[model samples]
Target: VTIIANLELKKQQLVLPKNALREAFRISHAIAEVTNVSSSARQPYVGVSAFAHKAGLHASAIKIDPSLYQHEDPASVGNDMRMLVSDMAGRASIELKSQELGVDLGGDKELIGRIVDRVKEMESRGFTFEAADASFELLVHEEVNGKRPSFFTIEHWLTTVERAEDQSILTKAEVTVTALGKKIICTGIGNGPVNAFDNALRTGLKQLYPELEVLELTDYKVRILEGRLGTGAITRVLVETTDGKGEWNTVGVHENVIAASAMALEDALTFGLLRQGRKPE
Candidate 1:
């Protein structure tokens, strides 16, 4: 569960993630028993569809009463019912999620309607929200209030690779970002391009978010959502981050792995600062 939860908590059953580890150990043990064996795609309680609702007749009944389709209350197992909004899901699902996430859909039904349409279009392109709630939350935030002020904006980043005198490879990176409308630049070196990029980005803003000093990247993952798209296939990046307290997951998707990784990394750092309510120039 540590490995999975570090990346995405929802995948780890019974754990109250991103909030507290109150039941993390017990829940991980229970999850081990369920996941140890070869089980069906639809497991008893933690499977993807264990508490998921489609946008069809079943969803219709769920809207009226959840008990209609759900054999048992998910809350009893420490999991709440959720919906996977796809092309088929009705507006009710999004509205319900808005209530759940506390997004202020308010009186603007048409605005949410547009967001729903946008989600469907993205799903059609193989961009899924099932494992990327951070990205989804950002999307909701953007749709509701437009782009809110971010911690900083990247002016540019550059990387160079060359052979050292001893015939070993050397990668160097330089990054500049604008925080509080002031430009800051820093340079770094790493084993490879991505590593160098990560280093430079962090060094550039260490003064702004000193928490970055304690931050750690526990794990990273990349997936090609659609092979048929070839070079245009969307890449989803999952990054696990921690400040030695607890771990949280952030995700990004793009046509380029580097770009996707950058997005996830940025989100992870941004989330870290937000969690601590820290802001610096």
Candidate 2:
């Protein structure tokens, strides 16, 4: 910073530890200016995927030395490396993630083939894994170990928005769950449709998953996708949730905003419970 003292030495003084970016972000969160950091995954320098490794050739090169593909070590910025498993995922990526997540893939060629094919199938249906690492982890654990993670299944649900004589809006939601063939219906009211659905869902899960009480929807974002020939267009919803312990995000793409929001919300809850090693009753 002492440019006047020595112009030639300005570069050395300007060089800063990568943690400086993280410190700035932390300060932003402290004043509530930035509601969520996970929302900025594409931000340069300190994003979750800033130093992420992909499958195939890229993953192979990174194994030899991350310096081949990355400009800097993720740790230099107080961030860790991420290896994403997706439809294009190769065996090398799976092996790397297995090592990181402690999952044993057992070196079976047929099993690895099946895993890759299944990921492709899900992706075809609009399921993405990049930002939802928790869901991906559970999927790998369940498929490789032949045991599914436990979570409640929705039987039926409905949402309604109405106006009273004074033109006040009323939003209501009702959800029913079929757990072990026992049905429980919960109805909740909120200021908006999404809020109403969330209220209903948490109210129903209260008796079963009390830990959900602490969970809150921290942020929500939606974008309209390009229209298809037969289909008009689709909506992509990204939902962030926090339980005081940590934060995670889930994404959903659908033709309807509400449906997309539902998908993200479901993934958020599933990831939250899985992280804590809990199985809903």
Candidate 3:
């Protein structure tokens, strides 16, 4: 009976100070941090997936009326509704996602169709954007503007790992990029090729875009799309970045793990720089 009442209260939000419920999401995360116990992503009201809609049909209905699908307005609980795009998505899903990302489609059905086709083609190649909204937004920008916002252009990058006579593994990287119309070369050493590459890229750009100093890679994940292909399988890498105030994810796909990681890391920093309002050079 007690559990039932609690559930009812949560569902109805009948308490006098209903706005206080806005803290529920933050409080839940705080509890996780304090106890080091993470809640399920499917947890009602607070879960990451609670308000995520994936179906084209759902997106269609949501365009007409969001209340048609969601039990409650996500914002009421300090959460947001997300429209995910995949190969299974349709025009509606792309339209909704574009709007969510602040791109004005202007009801251009032809343009929408093009974006949808591109999304499907990319997903077929193993690039999934559901969890990497930053990458999705970049794609949308490219589609809308005819090109991606660029802060720098890579001329060349090289990473090598070596074992010293003492048996210590050392990874070194050198990156060359053009920013602000001048070529910059930087070198860095790290524990792995990806880490070394990340260090080299950031070091090269730090002088020009000092805002890069605050950006940090918080998490990384890699998946082999086809295990049967063994070492030749396409690799997908997801990189999560934080700017002290917020976090975002980006993704990349390639046959080379290092190349895949570099793609994701590039997107991550590009998104971060864009967020910082630094004009691309």
Candidate 4:
């Protein structure tokens, strides 16, 4: 009887009823739909990954029926599924990608295999497809068409930099380019790598293409890979340029920041030309 006099207090539990839970879900879905509608009206930049996929099984299933792997129809997202072929892929996948590239794969198995192996090896060395470069695409085209750039070659380049307390850092870059059966040397000074290199390159190429002024740099970005403690680690550089007609992105990677930047700039120029239907020499 004395034990019954003592009692323990328990905390009250709060829970949503089934009906209330269902109503909450409906309200959240409605809010998301409204938000998406408003965002679509703003016309924001949508990336390829918005609809791109990489899973092998998913790719196979999508080839059969896109609905099997995708949450929304690619058309709804204004995108499509892309199947990439590499050494990791099967022959079926290779065939599909080859067909997409408009290559006759019926008798080109060896070539296709070689391309796949090359792609795999390059990708392992930090190459990527997230931002597909038309210049690299052109290289693939050339490899398939047996045509490649040979009109011009860089014999050598020399860059000199000087720092002053007051004025901007003076950068003088000189380049020797061989083109049209002749070797030409050009020099220019600018505030940075891009400007200096561009000034020099334009001076050299202007004689070949008088329309050099039409080309303009649109965007530039440098990314550090495995970067820690602000050290200049492996860096990937991207440059976007346009000739008032079309725009393209080109990429380069290197341990040397200046060298990587220079390579990216060159890639941008080369890609810009290719986009205009001009074959790089």
Candidate 5:
């Protein structure tokens, strides 16, 4: 049999018998098995799901034997196989997901029919659940609970702007928030609407959580839709922020660019506070 041995850097060469070729193949396979298991443990967040297929003929082949298409069984790489149903899906696929969710296929025909119809309708509207998995989870919870959230509420807001020469602008934003038998009003000033809004949000939240810090705005982007005269069009704003530990993104859309940026800014701050385990004031 082929023998395998670990040697120090100074003793790198190993003299072996010519008949040990078969043993070498076995040793190589054994080493490969161990390396595969070790590397899989270090796989990052995306992992195998980063490139799994779940549509068209590929899904069918995988369902038969994952080895047929997938480089490895999804489970081997710490990923569970998934199939996304859309307009292109057949009834079999729908039934599979329903059964997996523990829905009674025989008696729940009407509900299943409605779900498939709704999925098709929502997909047409650019509503995708693949990227925003948390949103999708919340949607499922709301559907099952039929319960409204009873959390903090925004009472009112006022924003004032002052224009200066050389394209410089100043903005002051004020917000009234009500939560947990308390009402707080805060105001802040900044170079732009989003900055002013974030400052106001932070001021309000800091009253409750004084240890909150290290949060900073990293980037902001705005896209104008329906370019009518290239001015007064629907604007979509994307905000990116980090809290020293991790970063997140949030988006808002509106006809007013400033309003869109303000909404996005509020979302970013709220998300950051949530991540820090503090409730918004």
Candidate 6:
């Protein structure tokens, strides 16, 4: 039972221990894991998107007093409010999101303005940072540090698909990456182009950062924007990755679907490396 459900049950005079209410999200997620069922992101109190705020107007009110928008204190149910940064974000939204991600913009009005402009411009190009916090955080860090962390340089990546004589489809990918001042070439075979490319890149980098071996791609989603153009439309790819303990999302946009997937995959690995506390070479 969830805190929301229990609250409703309590209205019927059913009693639930305070400790049980405190463990609401944990219990719901634990059940999901044991049953191998995914919890809805929109589930009432425990969903990932349940407490996510996207509107700039709401963010302004939240900045003034979170209670202005929240029906109840999120912490009372083991959840925290999330301020999403998007094209519609204002200074207050950026400030709150930056603080949430532990980035110290120091309330620099000029820098926040630049970030707002960047978010708007990028969103216009089909990049949706709201769903990809890893990529968004990376963007924030790039703006704050004047550059992105360089974990490795990809010289080239290529994927090929072929139908075998047995009528089975095979995909192979080759990647050349420079890491730790060494250039390495690796190849991998998988069920799809993106999977093959992911394997090739990780196989090459596992030499320098063994911690990457634990990183796994959990979900992949693609959306075609400007669908009127059919195959020629811009493609946006969102990838979810986990390092056993936590998960994060990254996004990419390109005219070529494979290229878009490659961009998302790169960001996924880069963010995973960052999570491992490995300094860029």
lDDT on C-alpha atoms for all candidate structures = 0.70, 0.71, 0.87, 0.60, 0.55, 0.87
Error of 3 at 178 (Å): 1.0
CA RMSD of all predictions: 7.5, 4.7, 2.3, 13.3, 11.0, 1.8
Rank by lDDT (best first): 6, 3, 2, 1, 4, 5
TM-score of each: 0.72, 0.78, 0.93, 0.68, 0.54, 0.95
- Candidate 6 per-residue lDDT, tens place, 1-281, comes to 55455554446444566445657777888899899999998887787777889878889899899988876666656777898888899988988999988888898999999899999999999999899989988888889889987798889989999998999999999999998889999999999998899999999989988999999999999999999999999999999999999899999999999899988988999999989998866
Q: Tell me model 5's lDDT, rounded to 2 decimals.
A: 0.55
Model 1: per-residue Cα lDDT over 178-234, one tens digit each? 886679997889987778988998998888777689888877888898889988888
TM-score of 5: 0.54
Which candidate ranks first by TM-score, i.e. highest? 6
Q: 1 or 3, which is superior by TM-score?
A: 3
Candidate 1 lDDT at 192 equals 79
Model 3 scores a TM of 0.93
Error of 4 at 71 (Å): 4.5
The TM-score ranking, best first, is: 6, 3, 2, 1, 4, 5
Error of 1 at 19 (Å): 21
What candidate 2 gets wrong by more than 4 Å, as runs, is 1-44, 98-106, 179-182, 226-232
Per-residue lDDT for 72-138 in model 5, tens only? Answer: 3443223455555555544444445444434335535554465556556654543443322222222
The superposed Cα distance between candidate 3 and the true structure at residue 281, in angstroms, equals 3.1
- What lDDT score goes with residue 72 in model 3? 77
What lDDT score is found at residue 146 in candidate 6? Answer: 90
Model 5 residue pairs with clashes: 2-23
